[model samples]
Target: MVNLTVTQLLRDRALADPEGVALIVQGSAPLTYGRWDERSTELANGLVERGVTRGDRVGLVFGNGDWADYAVAFFGVLKAGAAAVPLSDALAPADLRFMLGHCGAAGVVHAEGLEVAADGWTVTPGVLRAEASAQTSYDGRSAGDAVTDPPRPDDLAQILYTSGTTGRPKGVAATHANLAYGCGGKRRPFAHSRHLVHAFPIGTNAGQTMLINALDAHPAVVTLPRFTPGRFAALIESYRAGTVFLVPAMAIELLNAGIAGRHDLSSVLLLGSAAAPLPAPVAAALTGAFPNATITNYYTSTEAAPAQTIMMFDPERPGSVGRAVAGGRVRIATPQGEPLPQGETGEVWMRSPAAPRSYYGDPGSGTFRDGWIRMGDLGYLDPDGYLYLVDRESDVVKSGAHKVSTIHVEEAVFGHPDVVEAAAFGVPHPVMGTVVAVAMVVREPVTAEELRLFLTGRLAPHEMPAQVVTVGELPRNAGGKVDKRALRSSLTAPADLAPAHE
Candidate 1:
């Protein structure tokens, strides 16, 4: 059967390979397709019995240790004809309440020991058993009718909230067709590997993608309860994991901790970095760390899933995020929505081959138009059609008359051997509107002036940082992205710094 919906993927997989291992969490038992299907169905029956009807929204709050249960809850909501709003346990109580309320959720399915207060009914996975008595007092229809009438491809499958770095978080709703578009092929994804590993937390697009891969791909998914340099290395060595995925932050930690020499990572054939850009220095260092692996970087946003640029670490085009693959298209557009000439810097827009997703209530949002998604990034296309990012739209530093790319400045600063991590942003200046400032984490002793001198050869005079401060670490948002908004609040450039150039 061709799987057009998420529930069908599990149903078909369970029927074909009932005992095949689907998911494994470190320090926990493996879950087979048969058990996964049975447990999720049980939960779906429970949800239906509790008055969750078609098109209803259900919240799923889970921690990393609860990946197995989380997977069950995600599919169960679909089976009951409701959209699952998966949230991380790391979120604050107020944030959780705000999201659930914004969605007008009918109920929330939480992991055991996690406190969730929703206006609608709330139940934990433990009490969803057939034998366990119902927790909610709602007088609802029988479970049989709702579960039998499963959701269609156009029905809402999931709602993922943005990180809200710019403003309040917005919910991006995706229908079943949007998620299950390219997932119907006979050959499962990543077929060369027997096991795939990732540490993406719950409520993230990457984590949800992994869940779909576990359902549709050939390899059994493996993950850790928490991501640490040592434990992650041990898991790779222990499982001889062939496919490993991580963000740039984790990549930096692995390189800095020197875990490659301590553990035998020769089994890693494909090491993928996503959710953030991979700096050129970090990508170069990763090659030596995983000698047998092909380092790949993926670029996409929450609204543009299954439609990303995949760059396979080309030495010649180190900064290019690669052309759009998988039938997707990428183009540079002006602020007025006109396409720009090649090699011209402008707003980046990408169109997905799959059905597009939009803000839950605001389908008319300017972010999406005519099947194209504005990537919220500023970049240009090379002559060969590869995309090279200049900077984020919000991260561009505008000086007196010149606009500087923070990514360009950070990349130049990262070239320093002693520098571990760097973040560049705009700081207020009296003469110029805003001047460039940078914060860095370094290993060895290096003064601001010395680092600025090194950047002199790489960066233009106007693009250089006016102020440089050393820090032990950079501030990261809940989604693991650098918080430039927070940086702007706390850091200020020195008055005695060099003046901005015309």
Candidate 2:
């Protein structure tokens, strides 16, 4: 394995193909490989001049169009021996403030129009105005020469904040080796392919990893400022992209947008989905749409890279998430910490070298036990070694002394002919303590009685929803995971919807 830092990869690429296009955004001018190197070097020099130093944290708060500059900024920070903190663009102002403050960022780089209220120095595109001076030769030293004192592989390279769906966001400390291992391990096959299109927010770990992999492979990357089904199809057609990364919601949207016959997507070789579970129906739709493509689903978290198993596209195993990748192992244990028998449901635990060293600034210790990180997900490994996800442990609904897996109910409800999407949650019930209530987006008007009848054959009597509410849409988190907490808050008294009686 060629153990090279991300900065070294960029410098190597710049040296190999300076004139080749490195980045292309929808509205912005394309940046050539040479231009990217020069700009990053200039920004690194600028940051050094502006009081940034080794071990300092530099926060980045920008959208996709700024990825090129952000990449430069990120490498610049790394080159200066500082850590880069990339904040999500979708974060609320208060959450953003908490994260920036928690990370104790020395400075932040934002786009021109975003109004961030961090108590630190802010750098924007305006800093690039020093055209004549920005071109200075990286303080008169090349990147290769400045690497005499390169950072150790275990040194913190970046701090990525968790999605905070459960509570306050926590910073995940990632090392250069952790990232390089994750990026480099997946580098070869992707790089050898001719075409790959990435359509994720630039600040996300998925996005950063994809960027590094794309650059390392030197594949054609089609960037999108934000995901749109129409635009995605056009890019694939234009570039004849062979591989694509999509969140589950984006996959559904593509199907709803009728992408199968609208474009000649026959050239696509692989389709990967992550960030959330792709319902079996949607996965089937994708298989039908891209007959030649190998569809794969991955189970992972921001704190751990390639932490768990990956289920590659196989028609026989429809919903299985696959077995562990190289250097990773998984265990299924009960709530009381007892190991479950194979084919029994339990919480999923994973061990991988790519897992975070620790949560940043957290006083608590011993999160890892004998190299395994508890993933807090509910699932089981089949007797055949295939991994299956039941649902998020927190998402399980407790009603009338019975625990119901919301994913199971939602899957059954979504299997209904008229339903497009289904979200299940616990609603207040006077007698049952809490009752299973469901909200759905549908293609046709289906009465609550009809839905209950449809679910009768699919779910247990107690597991079926007590009341069904129709909604046009379900709220989602930044990564496009359905925000069940938000759905629970939107509920009115269950008396409004006609209650289903046994």
Candidate 3:
């Protein structure tokens, strides 16, 4: 087995080119590998001195503005042989508290100027870095003395909390082996670019993936403080970033704001969309926006990292999310965990090449079985092995005897020229038990009757939306995914009377 750890990659990079730029936040100075290594080493030793031990979980609370420090803290936790639990500054205080308690965190490392009150010890990265400096200068001690035992490949590296759309957030624990599975290879990920730009917020799986890319990929990772259409476009144009990554919501906003019309984004050679499926319409618009880039959609969950189906936008198969690549396998299975036939819709399952991740406190979440992770998605595999997603298992509308896919309904709504974004979900009905309903955002004013007319031939009799509500924006979770549960709660009024719709 090829044994590797996450810190090993960073160490190799720091040794190879100490002066090379490693990370950069927009409007901030660049962070070099030499400094990243030095700072993280000191912080690791400081953490070890402050009672952190192997297998202990440390909480990292940070915002996008402090991404460089967050990066250093992440490596420091690994180097200290402690599992890092990262949480966003944007998360609610209650949620943050819940996650910290859930993991029984040993200590907390928060960003400067941010207030996080944990039951255990809490310190900012600046404070840790300062204390390390004092110890080195006054005591003439090296950080390596404290961190005698470096982390091994099998050691716990991180515990990331999921965006709790259903119940309380669950912590997913991953080992150093899981995070460093695909690294230490001859070919670098995103090798076509000098600088790769993205606006993914800190604490999400997508954000962590970009963090790993910063350590392993050839490109210098560039990110904005936050995702605004104008700011994101400006970063791409200014950096002439050959590689870019974004989710569907950002893609919709960029297209709606006509960012490509105003900015020179032709330098992008590889554009990746993740977090959620890229709607066909948005994917097509991205092709025009980044004329020189290959628009790719990646499908993977937080539990199934490094195991994803990658689809380069193909006009012939626009709806497919592509086949599993890079030693990952995809399968459609029944609820009972039995494999289903091709073209048969069922639960989606994926397996990674690395050690499978599991829930931290609760081992039997039923999401992971053997080595495969249940995706909680309903999809079917075509003859060519491409996977086509229908909808979330919970989001699928069970209208009496007929089942409705929200994706199909939304795709039809996106076919209209006026529609900017749309979300479809199930609504309770007396006669049908549950019926299809839609919430949409459009560029121009359009009534429910007009949308019904637009979807008349596009949908079947049962597939048509029973109610259509127009909203200025769709509610999103921390991970930037549309919160269907929130939408369902908001549309609890009279069915005939649509909210914000005439």
Task: Report the number of the highest-TM-score candidate.
Answer: 3
- Candidate 2 accuracy as lDDT: 0.75
Best by lDDT: 3
Candidate 1 residues lying further than 4 Å off, grouped into runs, are 1-3, 130-146, 493-498
Determine the C-alpha RMSD for candidate 1 after optimal superposition of all C-alphas.
Answer: 2.5
Judged by whole-model lDDT over C-alpha atoms, candidate 3 comes out at 0.89
Which is the winner by TM-score between candidate 1 and candidate 3?
3
In candidate 3, the residue pairs with backbone N, CA or C atoms under 3 Å apart (3 or more residues apart, or in different chains) clash, namely: none
Candidate 2 segments whose C-alpha is farther than 4 A from its true place? 125-149, 182-187, 334-338, 363-367, 497-502
Candidate 1 lDDT over 296-393, as tens digits, reads 99999999887899999999999989889988999999876799999999999999888899999887899998999998999999988899999999
lDDT head-to-head 1 vs 3, winner:
3
Supply candidate 2's per-residue lDDT for 214: 54
Note the Cα lDDT for every prediction shown: 0.88, 0.75, 0.89
Ranking by TM-score: 3, 1, 2
- RMSD for all candidates, in order, please: 2.5, 2.6, 2.4
- The alpha-carbon lDDT assigned to residue 209 of candidate 3 equals 96
Sort the predicted structures by lDDT, highest score first: 3, 1, 2
Query: What clash pairs does model 1 have?
Result: none
Task: For candidate 2, write residues 1-502 as lDDT tens digits.
Answer: 3355666666767898888776677677777777766666556666676777778898888787677666666766776677889876678888888888998999887777877788888886448325325353454665323322466677788898877777677888887777766444444556534667777776566776676765666575667787788889888888888888888888878887898889888888889888887788778889888888888888777765747577887768777888888778787886545678998889887777553456889836444555566676899887888988887888887776678888889889978888888889888776676778899988889988899889887998778888788998888877677887788887847676444334
In candidate 2, which residue pairs clash?
Answer: none
